[model samples]
Target: MQASLFSGLPDRRERSTAHKYLAFVYCTNKEWARCDAAFDAAFDARPSFALEEYELQNTPWRDAYVKAQGKRGWQCSRPLAGQGSNNRPGQDSANPLVFSLNSTIITAITPLLPAAGGHSMALDGGSPGAFGARRPMRTENNVQLRVSPWANVTLNGKRLGVTPPLTEIKLPPGSHTIDFSNPGFETVRKTLKVEPEQSITITHDFDAR
Candidate 1:
């Protein structure tokens, strides 16, 4: 399934995330070379990629990550005044989960969700979210979406326009409402539980009940 998720990912940053995840899996399987290659691919996708502080200090893939960074003659950059922070599980911050586009998915939010405190860049290990300077981060979860046909997406009370292009949204951790509507099909509203560092899939098939 992880391999399948990488098929049509259009964003370079998202691609780096996929590579990093694959690297972790490879290392867990003891596929040393593949693990290193995956990390390298991640770097190629995004040079600014880095492991979170927790990812650097702990986790089974730490050594592999270090080795990968060493090959490039690099070190983790320090977090600017208010730019970096920890995003551990059960926390209110996380890396956005990515969804690759395909024929079946009309509107899917795959690139990731808003950062917890600030806009965060997706990274290899736990996301020590890199806050975005422009927008304020208000959510701690990333939601992956899949809607068939086409639909007008609405989250909370705001209209998210139509699908086929809407790929990112931000929301706080907790329960939120999402509405999917198409011309001939009935509107479907779903309530979801969002958590930090956890990826949730909200799929709606207008053709089905």
Candidate 2:
């Protein structure tokens, strides 16, 4: 699909889009080199691609993007104090130059109805909010799950066939809920609104006490 898109599209903008999409695909596959190549192709066609249009916050591939750009000295300017860094996952909080965010990470309080228990679960975190109230522009609905080594993951209250340490799942775009549970760690539940062709990644860090 990526090769077809790149080969078929010769226009600069279209090619740029293809490269960005390919970067996203490669990121999901954990192929950093191919992802970097895609980013290079994307920026060659559109120099301002990252600064003006690419989304860095809550994106699963930002770490790869940052490392790729760092090799080329494409340092991203930080957004500023209390401006928008809370939501960007891969940015360094102490080093402003490596961090940025276009909007706040939206969190809402909601009750989680248990699948089989009489008790209800209280969920307190949410996905990143719309960018500037106009909805961040997106293309696909990919869900990437970064679970702890021993955590079990469930989507929309349904347990996946796998047990733990899951990576990614592609789903239809819409509202989805995720839960991460382990014996010794606190179960985490979150609600996210997914957009078309947009990849959403949720990482469950089990180190917190």
Candidate 3:
């Protein structure tokens, strides 16, 4: 719905800064063609903006723009001053026009974090009431668990699985107990809060018993 709606926004269509974000939305949807086009438009909007201008750049948009470029075999010029640092990227204040509480509608965009081995981490959830809670859902969110070595996993009291990496599991919103255990290592446990329509990550490294 958002992509379709944004597709009609004059700013997005006319190659405004919005094109940078539209590219992100497209990337999230894995719409490579649209993503590339949106990014290309962004570059055309500011072709001379150099990486050294990182300090003055809109970081999220710039980072996503560069990532898209790299993935597409397009070369990006790195800022000479800070060649190898993982220093934070530039930041931009959210536009008040687009992010006011009084507004009937709003959109929040989260960047995709690519993991090694060609996997990507992304979270997508619909409107608050879209996923009905008629009689109370069995689970309202997905949790991604990462544990060192393989360990037995459990939710509440039921065993779920043993995992070197547990991609995801569903659980009700609010608080829940997670348990992990592996031979020769101390058992690990945690209490977590799960928000509806969001992804939570839990990482545990067991200490040798």
Candidate 4:
């Protein structure tokens, strides 16, 4: 992942700075695991990094960051707009906004993580509901299939196999191109984005010639 390179820098300050932005990306996408990991990494890399300084330099981004982090149970160090400052005695008014802003910065960089492998794609649950839960089971990830009656499936320009009605294929998380066709049916081509541990299912109906 291009972002992983940011983790390799020898400068703790540089790494922490990059992590702040990356955390924001991950949090925005609701990838809590990755977001939390990035946040922890940032703090661990620079225990004394000044949150106030970070917020002062990146105010608006910080606000959004805080709001995002709040969703994940992190408290903002400063108060919201119109609220009085909460800084400790002798310390800077612990503008709660500082924490809030940093929180958001953590979530903003999740999608950039590299896909699982060359053959995988990312998938999401889409919407919440009973039906949403059913989708994953119905769709398999990265499996080859023949579309019932008589059709062949080609993935990444390579002839794979055929798929049955409502068949699910197991694939790695990332992006992929699928081509479906049969002798008389119109060929359908599609690009799919799959996420890790997510399943994908497709149904095809052929017309008689």
Candidate 5:
């Protein structure tokens, strides 16, 4: 669809519109590299592309891309207090500070969410069911969970959302038992210890009865 649009444009005006549209589509789809490339190409073709216009159209995307890149140390600036340096009141500088990428990203992006909070949690591993020795970490405030529709989700004792693909939800820090249920499938239960500046993932599969 995108390729078709890109190829269909004939005039400079049409081409410029196509580029902007493609950039927006990429951004909406969370294709950061493609979005940046599209915008870059547009600007290259039309140097007159206004920064304000670009920003208005791409600020959310740019912020997300910058943050995603920052996690991998792609384009991060040094903090005034310095990396892993804590300035807690009366705290000794000798104390070690742990630098958590998940915590930093969440803290940086949460403010961008609507009044309900725009924060979303990410599974560390590509596959949710793949579990390692380390358990998933939950954020202190407004923790978000994304799960597959095939996977059931329940908070406390009450059933929360449906299985397969689950909607994102905001949760406070503490202990929460998530029950995954599927008909003709074995139930999976996970106990999560939630804290601020932490991200965790839990994955399981149910067998058909």
Candidate 6:
């Protein structure tokens, strides 16, 4: 893990950033205690560390970030880095060592929207089990994917393309199945239950798997 590696690095700033990301990882998985711990580690490593304003607004782990600060008996000072409204994490390419990727962005499943610059591909196959079962057209439910190293995706035996995958996946309230497979990693199959207007985020990291 990059977090572990960064923990031992000579630079405290890098370590803090790594732990910040690790917190998001635990947050996405709903591991509350570990999430708080990772944030604590970040602040402990570099007290000057802070997140940008946009991060607090758009990221899925904002709740966890708040809880982490609450556990520390304090609140974070906003945008301590002095980054402007137009600034973003990867916008600066001046330093080769400065690339930071946030893997905790929640991904949504789709019926495959061609408008999102992704050409929707439908694989003709067997009947779509309960997933394809008829229900009200109200797309009141959503399925979000968080798969690492990516995988060939399938929903109820109907292909949904691969991870780093197609977006805008909307479905009616019900149960569905999705399968994730990679060349050497273990294939992951997930059964999702969606209620009206409910969103479920599935997290999978194919490590030694």
TM-scores for all candidates: the values are 0.36, 0.36, 0.32, 0.31, 0.31, 0.40
3 versus 6: better TM-score goes to:
6
lDDT of 3 by residue, 101-123 (tens): 12111122122232323112232
Please give the lDDT score at residue 185 for candidate 2: 42
Q: Alpha carbon lDDT of residue 71, candidate 5?
A: 43
Question: How high is the CA lDDT of each candidate model?
Answer: 0.53, 0.49, 0.46, 0.45, 0.43, 0.53
lDDT of 4 by residue, 32-69 (tens): 55656666667667764434533423222344444445
Off by over 4 Å in 5: 1-149, 207-209
| Candidate 1 regions with alpha-carbon error over 4 angstroms | 1-8, 78-209
* Candidate 6: count of backbone clashes, pairs at least 3 residues apart or interchain: 5
Per-residue accuracy of model 1 over 1-209 as CA lDDT, tens digit each: 33345435778787787677666546544567877888888887788888765344223356677677877887656332333332333446344323333322124343322111211223224433422122223343255455543356777766654443344554555777888765444678877555555444455555453
Once superposed on the true structure, which residue ranges of model 3 sit more than 4 Å away at CA? 1-141, 207-209
State model 5's lDDT. 0.43
The list of candidate 4 runs beyond 4 A from truth reads 1-146, 164-168
Q: 1-209 in candidate 6: lDDT tens per residue?
A: 54566568678886786677666555544456776788878888887767766456433356567665766677767742433222123344232111122322223333221122211122113543322223334443355555553456677787655443333355556677778765434577777655564545455666532
What lDDT does model 2 reach? 0.49
What does candidate 1 score on TM?
A: 0.36
Locate the minimum summed-lDDT window of 10 residues in model 3: 97-106
Give the higher-lDDT candidate: 1 or 5: 1
Give the Å shift of residue 193 in candidate 2.
19
Summarize candidate 2's per-residue lDDT along 94-148 as a digit string, tens digits.
4222223222221111111112222222222352354112233242225545543
- Model 5, 1-209: lDDT tens digits are 44344545566555554565456445544466776776665554554443232233213344433333344444433222222322223535443212122322223112111112222234436556422223444433344443322444566877553322132344455677777664333567767666555555344433212
TM-score order, best first, reads: 6, 1, 2, 3, 4, 5
